[model samples]
Target: MQYIRNFCIIAHIDHGKSTLADRLLERTQTIHSRDRKNQLLDDMELERERGITIKSHAIQMEYKYKGVSYILNLIDTPGHVDFSYEVSRSIYACEGALLVVDAVKSIQAQTVSNLFLAIDRNLTIIPILNKIDLPVANKEKVTYEIMYLIGCTSEEVIYSSAKEGRGIDKILEAIICKIHPPKGNLKAPLQALIFDSFYNTFRGVEAYFKVINGQIRKGDKIKFMSSGKMYTAEEIGNLRLKHISKSIIRSGDVGYIISGIKDTLSIKVGDSFTSVNRPAKAIIAGFKKVNPMVFAGLYPEKTEDYDNLRVSIEKLHLNDASLTFFPESSIFLGSGFRCGFLGMLHLEIIQERLEREYGISVITTIPNVSYKVFLKCSPTDIFLVDNPSDMPDIFNIERLEEPYIKASIITQVNYVGAIMSLCIKKRGMIKNQYYLMPQRVELIFEMPLSEIIFNFYDRLKTISKGYASFDYSPLDYRFSDIVLVKILINHQLVDALSTLEHRSNAFYIGKKMCKKLQKIIPRQQFDISIQATIENKIIARETIKAVRKDVTAKCYGGDISRKRKLLLKQKKGKKKCSLLVK
Candidate 1:
C-alpha cells in the first residue's frame, strides 16, 4: 500500500522553520544520539552561520501513532526575498505545505507569498501557529489574521510550541488525517519528479524523487526527459525514519537512487523520470529558468591562485546550479571570470566558501543589478547587463528601462510620517496603504530596485525603530534616468568600482564611497586627488592630503635592501585592492 504525505515547511525569516524540523527529528528519533547535530537538515556550514536556510533540504520520517505508521516527507525552504525563486521550485515538488506562522509576529511578507504559492499548486494547506511559549505571542489576533488572509477556517488551524516539543504529535496526526496521499499506477510507464539531486564522490550521482505514476527499482534503466539522457539505477533506498533498517521504496515514497552519472548538467531540478523503454514527456513548461539578478567580477588576488578559483567555482556549482561563470579579462586586473548569482546573499555565500573552504583570496568588483535599455529605432532592442561598463553609451540611449519592484512596508501607524519622508528621499511613489491591525498599517510603494540597493531595509528598520517589515517583488521594467557615477583618482577613472544610481543621491553617495576607498588605499607616498566624474565633468572631489613623513630620514645604508624589498612586496601584495574607505 502506498500511503505517503508530502509537504514543505514555509515561514518568514527567524520564524522557526529549522527549529521546528529539529524538534520533529528528535521526537521521531531519526538521528541517533551519536549522529545528532544542531539544525540537522541545514547541513551547510554557511546556512548554520547565517541562521537562514540558503538551499532547500528534504528528509523523510515515519511516525507510528496508535499503531498507524505514516510516512512524511518534509522540505525546508529559504524564506528570504533573494531565494524566492528557489522557494517556488521547492513548493512545486510537494502536494501539501506546513505553513508555519509565528504566534507573536503573526503574518509577514513571505508568509503571504508562500501561502499563495501553496494555493497555486492546489495543495492541501495545514497552518500551524508556532512559538506560543514566547511572551509576545498573540494567539487570538494571529489566528484571526491567518484565517482572514489564507481563507482557512479558524477550526482548521493547529497550535504548537515546537520548541518545548509540545503538540508535535497532534501536528503529525493532522497531516495523516487531512493531507491527501498520492494515487498512481505502480506497474505503468515510469513517471517521477526529480525534485533534488547531489553529486557524491563515491557513488557518483544521487537523486531523490517522488514517483507520480509507475514502479521503479534497482537495475532498471532510467531516462531523464529534459536532457534525453539514459542511466541505470545502481541502488534504491528509502530514508530511514528512525535510523532503522533500509526498506524498498515504492510509488509515492520519497527515496534516493544512485546511478553512475557524475555531472549535474544531465539531471536538473523539475526534470521528470521515465523508463528507457517507455518514456514520458518532461514537465518542463512551468519550471522557469533561474535567472541571475546580480553580476560581479570575481578573481583570485594572487595570479597563481587562478587554478584554485576554477576548482572552487566548479565545486560550488555542484550544489548551486543557478550560479554561472564565464572567462573575462580587464586591462587593470588581467584575466579573470565574471560570475552571476540570484542575489547578494548568493554571491556572498559563494565568495565566503571560496575563501574559507578552498583557502583562496579573491578580489570582487561591486555587484550590479540587470538593466534593459531601448534605443530609438524601428525595432526596439533589449539588453541584459551586469557591469556599468556595458551600459549603452549615454548618447545612443533614447529610453532606459530598469527593474522596478513593488515594495510593501509594515509599521506602526505612529511612524508612518517618518517612513514616508525616507521614501520620498529615495524617489519612491506611494501606491496605497491598508490597516493590518488596530495600530499597524501595510504601506505599499512602487520603487526602483536600484533605489533600495544600498541599505534601504536597514534604514527603514532604523526609522521605525525595528518595527518595520519589508517585502518586495519585481513589478516591471520601466523607463528611468539611469546615470553612471564614475569614480576617478587624480583624474584617472577607476573601472573596478563604478556604480549606477538614481540621480537624486548621486553626489552625496559618490563622495562618501570615494572617501571610503581613499582611506583604505594607504596614502600613496604622494598627494592624491579623488573625484567623481560623469561624462567629462566632475560631480564630487576630495584630496588625500599629501603624506609628509613616509620615508625614514634617519635610516642607514645596511637596512635599505630590506626596507625597499618590504615596500615593493607590500605594493605587489594588496595589488587587487583599490579605492579609499568611506
Candidate 2:
C-alpha cells in the first residue's frame, strides 16, 4: 500500500490526456516496444476511427524510482464533457490527479470543471502543460494560467511535450514525491469500490475496482453490497495491457475481478463489494448514479429485430454504464426503448456504435429532456416525462418543470456580445461573467438543457471562430410555461414529430417544423397539408402541391369537343382525388 499510487489524467477535449497516458505507459515499459501506438488505452475501434475517446480505460504500471518499486494505477479518462461523470468516478477512486492543459489553448471550460471535481475530492493535483513542442505554443501565458488556477508556484508546473516524451521523468518523479500513498487498514472488513465495469461474452461480467480496505483473492465468495448478489471470484487479477491473474490483491491496490455474474444490472459502476461473511456496514459515500440529461426513443428499423436489438442494447449498457434505458411502446414507432444519454454527442456515439458494432438499424425520434409534470387533480404527484407524447393534456397539467443546467463557456472577449445574444435567444440568463486573462473571458449562464443539447455548441463555436469552449452540469428543476407542439399530416397527428416547447417559442418552432415537413413529404396525386397544432388549433401550415399533368396542353388543338371532354374529365378526376382538410 505504501508503494501504490492511484491517479487519473484530467483535461478538456483534445488536450493530450490520452497521449500523456501513452507516454507514461511507455516510460514505465509496461508495453513491448513493438506494441507502441497512439491512444493505446483507447482500444475501441470506434475511438480510433473518430479520433475521440468514448470510454474510460484503467491500467496498472510497474515503475522503478531510485531504489524502490512502485505500483502506479493510471486511469485514462475521456476529456469530452459528455463523459464527465466517468471522470468523477475515476477521481473518486484515486488519491491524485494530473491536470493537463494545452499550451496553445491555455484553459477551457471543461478544464476548470474537472479541476473543481478533483479539488472537491481533496486529491493532490499536478499541473502539466502539454504540447510544448509545437512552434505556436504560448508556453509562458499558459503556465501563468495554470499557476493561477491551481495556486501553485512556477517551479511546480511541469513543462514537457507529451508527444516528444520530454517531461515523462518529471511527471513520474512528481507522482512519487508529491502524491500521498493510499491509506487503508488491511485488517478491516473487505470493502471495494467498483469504479468501472463491462460485459464479456466468454467470461461473464468484469468489474474493475480499487480495494479500499481489505484484500481479495481468487475463489473468495464476494457479494455486491448494493445488489446483495453473491458470486465466487472466477478470476482475480491486476489490470495490465491484458488481465494478468494474481493470487490476491491487497488494500490500496487497483485490480479486476471476473465473477460468474451474467446479468448486466447486477454489476453496477460505483457499487461496493465486500466478503459475504464479513460485509461492510455501510456503502461508499457519494454513490449516486449518473443522471442522464438527454432522452430519445430508439426503435428497431424492422419489428422482427426487437429481440436482437434488446440484447445488443444490454451489452452496450454494460459497456457504458451511464446509459439508462427502459422498455417502452410507442404508437408511431411500436415497441422500443426510451433511452437517456449524458448529452447529444453521447447519443450520436451510441447510435453509431449500434450500427457498426452490433449491426442493428434503429429509428431515432426527436430528442427531449426529462420533465416533471404535475396533474391538477394530484398536484403533489410528479409524473416524470421524457417523451413529448407522454405529456398530459394542458387542462390536466397543474405545473410543468424543466431541467436547467449551468453552462460554462470560455472564449475571447471580442465574441462575448454575440455569445450573450445567442444564449439569450435560447432563454438563457447570465449568472456570472469574468475575464480569465487580458483578452480571454469566461461566462456562466443558467439555461434549459433542451435548448443546448442540439446545436448550441455548434453555434457557439461558429460565432466564436472556434475559440469558445463549453461545458455544463445539471442544475435544479424550475417551473416553466411549456406546451406540447404536435405535428399533423392531413389532420392526423404524428407522435414521432411531437415536442414539448415553451409557449413563447412554440409557434415559431411549429412554423419551422411545418416548412421542413413540406419539403420532405413527397408530392402525391393530391396536395398534402402539413399542420402544427396545439390541441385543436393549428398554429402553422404548409402544403405540397400535387403532381399534376396538364390535361389541356396534352390535348393540343385536335377539336373543341375533344378538348372540352378532356377538360371535363380531368376536373371530375380532380374532385374525386380528395383535398385534405377542406
Candidate 3:
C-alpha cells in the first residue's frame, strides 16, 4: 500500500489529457512499443472517431523510478460538461489528480469546473502545462493563470508537451513523490466502492471498484449496500491495459470482481460492496447517480422496429445508467420511447450509437427541458412537465417556471461584444465578468437552459471563431412569462413540434418555425396549412400549395359545356379534400 499511487487525469475537452495518459503509459512500459496507438485510454471506436472521452478507463502500471518500484493506478476521465458526474465519481475513487491545461489556451471553463470538483473532494491536485511544443505556447502567462487559479508556485507547476514526450519522466517522478499513497484498513471488514460497471455476455456483470477498508479474494461472498444482493466472487483482476487475473486484491487497490451476476439492473455505479459474512458497520460514501437534464422522444422510422429499439435502449442503458427512457406515443410518428440524457452531446451520441451500433434508425423530436407550472385556482398546487404536449390548459395555469443554468464562457476579449449580443437575444442576464488577463476574459451569465439547449453553443463557437469554451451547471427553476407554442398542420396539432417559448417573442418564433416547416413538409394533392398557435389562437401560418393538374387545359378550344363540367368536378373534389382535412 505504501508504494501504491491512485490518481486520475482531469481537464477540459481537447486539452491533451488522453495524450498525457498515453505518454505516461509509454514511459511506464505498460504497453509495448509494437502495440502503441493514439489515445490508448479511449478504447471505444466512437471515442476515437469523435476525439473525446465518453467513458473513464483505468489501468495499473508498474513503474521503476530511482531504483524503487511503484504501483501507479491511473484513471482517464471524460472532459465534457455532460459527463461531469463521471468526472466527479472518478475523482472520488482516487487520492490525487493531474490538472492538465493547454499552454496556448490557458484555462477553459471545464478545466475550472473540474478543478473545483477535485478541491471539493479534498484531493491533491498537481498542475501541469501541456502542449509546450506548439509555437503559440506562452508558458509565462499560462503559469500565472495556473498559479492564480490553484494558488501554486512556479516551481511546483510542471511543463510538458505530451505530443513530443517531453517532461514525461518529470510527471512520473512528481506522482511518485508528491501524491500520497491511498490510506485504508487492511484488516477491517471488507468495504469497497463500485465506481463503474459494465455488462459482459460471457462473464455477466463486471464491477470495477476501489477497495477502501479490507481485502477481497476469490470465493468471497459480497453484498451490494444498495441492492443487498449476495454473490460469490468468481474472479478478481486488475487492469494492465487488459484484465489480468489476481488471487487477492488488498486495500487501497483498484480491481474488478466477476460474480456471475447476469442481471444488469442489479449492478449500479456508485454502489458500495461489503462482505456478506462479516459486513462492514458503515457503507463507504459514494457519489450521486447522474440525473438527466435534457429529454427527447425517439421513434423508430418503421413501426415494426419498435421492439428492436426497445431492446437496443435496454442494452445501451446497461453500460450507461445516466440514460433514462419510458414509453411514449405520438400520433404522427407512432409509439416510441421518451428518453432523457445529461445534455445535448449525450443525446446525440446515444442516437448515433443506436443507428450505428444497434442498426436501428430512429427519428428524434426537438429536445426540451422540464418546466414547473403553478395553478391559478389552487395557489399552492404545482406540476412538473417534461413534454409540452403534457402541459395543462393555459386558463388553469397561473405562472410557469423554466430551468435556468449558470454558464461560464472563457474566450478572447475581442469576441465579448458579439457574445453579449447573442446572449441578450436569448434572454440571458450577465451575472459577472472577470478579466483573466489583458486579452482573455471570463463571462458568467444566468440563462434559461432551454435557450442554450438549442443553437447557443454552435452560435457562440461561430461568433468566437471557435476560440470560446463553455461550461454550465443547473440552477433553480425561475418564474417566467413562457407559453407552449403548438404547431398545427391543416388544423391538427402535431405534438412532436410543440415547444415552450417566451410569450413576447412567440409571434416571431412562430413565424420562423412555420416558414421552415413549410419548406420541409411535402406538398399533398390538396393545400396543407402550417399554423403556429398558442392556446388555440393562431400566431403565424404558412401554406404549401397543392399540386394542381389543369383538368380543362386539354379542352382549350372545346365547348363551354365541357369546361364547366371539368370545373364542377374539380370544385367537388376540392370540397371533399377540405372536409377530410377538417
Evaluate all candidate structures by whole-model CA lDDT and list the values in order: 0.78, 0.90, 0.91
Candidate 2 lDDT, 108-194, residue by residue in tens: 999999999999999999999999999999989989888878899999999989999999999999999989999898999899999
Q: Which digits, one per residue and each the tens of the lDDT, describe model 1 over residues 101-163?
A: 989877787777777888998888889999999898999998988887878888888888978
State how far residue 408 of model 3 sits from its true place (Å).
1.1
The ten-residue window of minimal lDDT in model 2 covers 573-582
Model 1 is weakest, by summed lDDT over 10 consecutive residues, at 573-582
Model 2: how far is 454 from its true place, Å?
A: 2.1
Model with the higher TM-score, candidate 1 or 2:
2
lDDT for model 2, please. 0.90
Against the correct fold, how does model 2 do in TM-score?
Answer: 0.96
Error of 3 at 485 (Å): 0.8
lDDT of 1 at 191: 83
